[model samples]
Target: MGENINFNIVLFEPEIPQNTGNIGRTCVLTNCKLHLIKPLGFSLDEKQVRRAGLDYWKDVDVEIHESFEELRKKYKDGVFYFCTTKGKKYHTDVKYNRGDFLVFGKESAGLPDEVRNSDPDRCIRVPMINTTDRSLNLSNTVAIIAYEALRQVEFPNMK
Candidate 1:
């Protein structure tokens, strides 16, 4: 009945194939785009991904970008919000809508300095429990944020 609200999940040099696969599944279920920035730690067809994502890959709409710069140029006007453990703003507070690009950093180092500092004000994070050394899994975190965004837009039933 109305235009579907689309969100983009950008993975910056993702290290874990399974995590990427899980994120892909989330995108498929939520009706969003998943962007992978190379060079990835493993091939997209790696065993871990196939196992984790099951048979969802066929239906997943995934875009592979050569670099972060490519995504920046393509989505210059869209809001790019980097999700990091060190982000100043909480992910829940950000008003997500259609056309928002939510970017996540690598598994090992999180986001690089250039990316983390590029748009300090837009980066966001999910608040973690106290006394924890690490944050939520990359794919898990994306699911949380992406679903919230989809929910905000009212999850319209598109035929």
Candidate 2:
């Protein structure tokens, strides 16, 4: 991705270390920033995390926040798009821009009501088949939304 273009991938209370590591690698590949909220399920030093990232974890731009409010305070001017199954629009519907914040919630429960309600118009979701599956995997969800945003921007700086 272009050095001038940047996006933020916010994970609120991610439960799995492997997923977080995988997402971290994705961020590194896409030139996006990774924001991890507090109360993560696994320690950052866990072997699973390192194994998933495969020596690239250090290269990933990762930021840890004590809470969502802290993250909001840091990026007060950011345009946040909360990814949830209850989103009113599909992921591709939004016109993504550089520096947009793509927020995802916990694996099992998804984003809390307060968060989803915070900015209802900004909520988005991936179009999934009508099945019993409650939602997609956390890492997969991030990749889908991230790539969609990248695609809309013509894959800037990506060869």
Best by lDDT: 2
List residue ranges in candidate 1 displaced over 4 A: 1-5
**On residues 1-159, what C-alpha lDDT tens digit does candidate 1 reach at each position?**
013537888999999888988888888887788889999999987989877788998888788999999988887777889999888899888888787899999999999989889999988998888654788989889988887777777764533
* Cα lDDT tens digits for candidate 2, 74-118: 788889999999998999999999889999999989999998999
Best by TM-score: 2
